[model samples]
Target chain A: MRAFLSSMVTPRALALSALALSFFFMMTLGGPFYYLAAFVITSVFSLLDMVGGQDNSDNDGKPWYYANIQAYQIPFAMLWFGLIYAWYLGTGMSDLFGVGGFLKTHTGFDMFAIRARTTAPELITGGYCLATIWAGFGTTIGHELTHRTWSKVAIITGRWMLALTSDASFSIEHVYGHHLTLGTPADPATARRGESVYHFIPRSTFGQIISAWHIETGRLARKGQSIWSLHNRMFTGWAMTLAYAGVFYMAAGWKGVIIFFAISWFGKCYLEAINYIEHYGIVRVAGTQVEPRHSWNCNQRVSSWLLFNLPRHSHHHAMGDKPYWELNCYPDAPMMPHGYLTMIYIALIPPLFRKIMHPRVLDWDRRYAVPAEYPLIVEANRRSNTADFINNVAPAE
Target chain B: MFSKIFGSATKPATVTILPADISFIVEPKKTVLLSALDQNIKYPHYCRVGSCGTCKSKLISGQVRELTDKSYTLSNEDIQAGYILACQSVPKTDLVLEVPKLRVE
Candidate 1:
């Protein structure tokens, strides 16, 4: 019983289980207000960062659960997707048993539907709630699945989730481009000093797609296959998105289409905002090596629990295939002031972001960066207009 | 010491790595990972100093000499499980290897 219970309650499993709660929240509260509620939940987690652990390490032994966890989650993620799809389309059993209906039955009053708010406003939030599901857990699930090299199903399903976000080529660029060139000028995914979410999003979105295109083209080219071959992953990804969009059009007309893009737009921004903060201002030589210091890490327990220790990012970079439950908190890696959720909220205000993170970046340089790499670090700061802040305040660089 | 472990004097050896299903002959005395990088074949690695264990691979069918000590770097079970650190080992004979598909750059 103990082993059985332990297997079911692993941190990785618990983090994924949090996805169902988001759906429940949506079902309980219809319209744009649910987003407000979700945002507050995130804010509360953000404020609790003070007590979060910084040096937690994974336990040495793998639970019997590790083998079957992915197999278990795939169906769960799919069903979660199905429920959100039903709610958004206002179709099938969801037409009566959906968010509005659920509220009416549960509380004996449906404030949203009883008050009879206009479709335009409800639809606006309806789209947002749907997208929130995608970014919050859908993308997280996709990220986990895409890491499996042996399982084509996991890869395809992961890409399928990303395509719903209109980012089908994430695995291609993520594996070949971002990983190969992280913390360097060559990796467009690495947010430079002074690069805000607004600025980073467009550049990363376009650059990643372009990088995936070139990377895929070259890969196929090496095999003597044409760029236009059915093997082109970039084309296949975009085709998947188009097909998904077509399904939305047929189901709910222009309103559904609008909702799809809106949800995708917001989801992509959420995804990129997390990216913007993850590697902000860190630089490494293009082809040299990667260490724990290249990535910024946080260990706020709530964020770790919710995101399955994604905040323990230094370990992720160093041991790429290590499961989330197995990731360690490296003492030497750069630390974030708050959990990922709160830090993302902080990133919206560029000045505060610089105030907090710039000093940390410079400190990482002093401790980990070699003397030969100093020039590169200095140049990166100068190019980003952060040198003055770094030089003036850092301990006698 | 590194050059001697990965220099021009020794006989070149073939390394066959999978998931990619590609094989290539590596420079004499060079770490199998260095040769992979030179060929732009993607292989996992972190902290080239034989820590992090990111480059750990299973030696499917070959002999390798560890340039760095594996006593502390790899667990005894891993060594018994046929795992070799690609970044710290040179093939003594033609080799076959397997790795988990994971993140990279």
Candidate 2:
């Protein structure tokens, strides 16, 4: 029974199952209490699995590289689950139990006063509903197929999931642009030194998308194909996003459209936060043009398992085609102190993040400094220091 | 009679001199660093292709044959200072090398 359950509960499969179960329980239980409990339970377990490292041997041939890639949804899903739980417990229960009677008779607070002061229930519901769709459907499946290891089946499934959140373009840009140019300045996803998460997120997200389109169009042109043609992934992704808006309009009117866009923007932001944490302050050697030292590795046991060993980043860069399951923990790779989710929260506070990460970054810089490899940058810094020294000198004879 | 004949005929082969403090039991054809790693001593290495100089180590006292990948990551000054890539060097004789201690998370 344990083995059977384990086989069935792959990271992607588990997320999808939990989403379905939560949705069904929400409708069937007909009360906010049961719905909140179920969502909370599912979310907690998902969080655990993400943090608790997985045995790579269990993955077999399934490609671990994509594992961490898709695991972004775990935290996103958890955050959404928490919101839904709060709303269901707070508002939905009140509505179901007769808001006026429950408040006045049970607690003696004026129900009318509370209702007038708070935001409308519909907005909260709509926002959470969209969050659920983006986290479970878009991030989970989109992330998996973006790897595209097994077959076209995997890729197609992943893209459709991303389409739900109107971020299908990520599938193309991530594989073509980010993966190829990772750790280099050419890759917009590669954050520079001294850039904060606030600065990096928008730049990386928009830049990567535009870069992906250019890359794909350039490739197609080389092959005598046109960008106007339907064969392009970028066009397909956009069409799917538009279709999502149309679906939203038909399903829930103008509010649904507003809710959908809001959810997508939030989801994209969440994804960028993960990216910011993953490669923070790490850059490839300028002259050697190597990718290994370019990205920082985070192997905190919980984050590694949750992110599909993504925190084992240096290994991934060293062997891009190597499946995630086979990704080894190289002793030499620079490491992050915390997992992606924890780091994301830390990144919001610039001073706190700098305090924690600056020491580690400086240590890595000094320990791994190769004077020959980056002579120009080092020399320039040295010359500037010398100039400072001369200016500070008290009229040296 | 047999013991006397065999013993007098051959002087015992002399053992090669090795560094007193920094002793490395290197594989005959492999570099000192590679030998250390194969023997379960974790050595720092990035871009094993020698593009990154993360694995640079000093040759304290020994001879080594360099592979083609060595020249680029190492500067002319590094060669004078006895720096070599453990991945690229083949130990020609017994050697003592300074391995940098790096913290790997």
Candidate 3:
């Protein structure tokens, strides 16, 4: 009994169970209409995860992934409660004042039934706000966790939350593909120099998904594993999503599923937009090994708070396994000019960004240049005589 | 070796201002911006990573070498027009750069 209780209470299982209960309770309370909406939202994310969650195994062990899971647990739990409370407040407020009466006096809308039937206005709006925050935190954590050694519980919990945000596939592409070939032309996530966020997102989203399919297919072929194999993360994610949609269809029907998809897609897009901003214009030099300088860093306080310190990006790239809470600001890491949100707003204006960024870039360039007295020639000459002694094989080898 | 690493062996270069008739001594290995900052000269900068083009300026004359990290932020056109990142550009020879005073907003 104790062992069973402990298993049920593990962070991964707890979160998964909470999300499931929330989905069912909300649907039952709001009727089939709301349930369909939730289903659609989750199913879409499930599909994305199916495509995105491919081979991301690394021999480096699972400490980092586990750490990320632990780091995100508290914040996500808080966000979940915050959403629930916010919904309760919004509905109570609307009903207390009689939404129809309030609207009739304020906006002059004649649809009495619409206002009267505002079952949970606060719940709808507040739920969305909280959901957005959850999506951000959960998706990042889920992405890391899914890459760990197989834990049936972890996979289900992580992938389910990821799908609800319509970003399930990020787990696969980011860990498996992007990290493996980061800063290279082959990696879709690495932004080219002078590329804007607006242009990078659509291309990366589609490109990464297609690449994920090829990666998984190749992996299965090599290992003699069938596409239908239960061990496949991609297959499992898709199957769960399809199963979810079927559940939605059975419980609340198509309408609930559609609504769920719309909201989840919106959340997913928001997350992707952030990904675009996080590493915009940051590229690793082709044929060179990955280095910290290859990724952009932001240390702004508010953006860091909002995204659980995700803006301290260069370090994350250098050590993807570091838990979000423990991620540090490295002085040598290139710094973003502003907070992530402010930068996102600025990214919309290419010319303004270019004008503002040009000098800073030039300044950084000039700062890192080698001194004239210590030119490459001088260093080469100094090393020439020492080279033979160091190698110990004479010049023949 | 210690003196060389600390940049104490070399005599600092002087930048002579034409109209003001004032001059400042610039330390070796310090970018013009850093030197100016040391002398309490505030300059504009944002996203110091080179992605946000905030700190661009035209070089009037003289040679400047860019730090390796800042190279990605500059374009060929910028190099041709004598534009360099003040934050990145260390004076190779004495430099006469036409830089806009940092805005006081």
Candidate maximizing TM-score: 1
Docking class of 1: incorrect
lDDT of 2 at A136: 39
Please provide, for model 2 over A1-397, each residue's C-alpha lDDT reduced to its tens digit, 9 standing for 90 to 100.
Answer: 6655565567655655565566544522323334364344335534654565533232244444344444444434533343333333343224322534564688785534443444555445535544544553446446654564324655666676676556677776665456655655677887655667898888988897888777667556544567788878788887876766565555445665666677667767767777787676554544343455656776555555445566677776665444556667665667666655467668889778877876665555556545543442333223333332223222121
Best by DockQ: 1
TM-score of 2: 0.56
Candidate 1: the clashing residue pairs are A179-B104, A179-B105, A180-B105, B6-B29
Q: What interface RMSD do all candidates show, one decimal each?
A: 12.5, 12.3, 15.8
Fnat for each model: 0.10, 0.05, 0.00
Model 2, B58-85: lDDT tens digits are: 8777566665334434565776787877
lDDT of 3 by residue, A301-387 (tens): 445544556776766766554456556776576666766656554666866765655444333334422243123223322333433
**Selected candidate, larger DockQ, 1 vs 2:** 1
Stretches of model 2 off by over 4 angstroms after superposition: A1-137, A286-292, A369-397, B1-105
Model 2, C-alpha of A148: deviation from truth (Å): 2.1
Regions of candidate 3 where Cα sits further than 4 Å from its true position: A1-131, A147-156, A242-252, A348-397, B1-105
Off by over 4 Å in 1: A10-22, A28-41, A48-55, A60-119, A387-396, B1-105
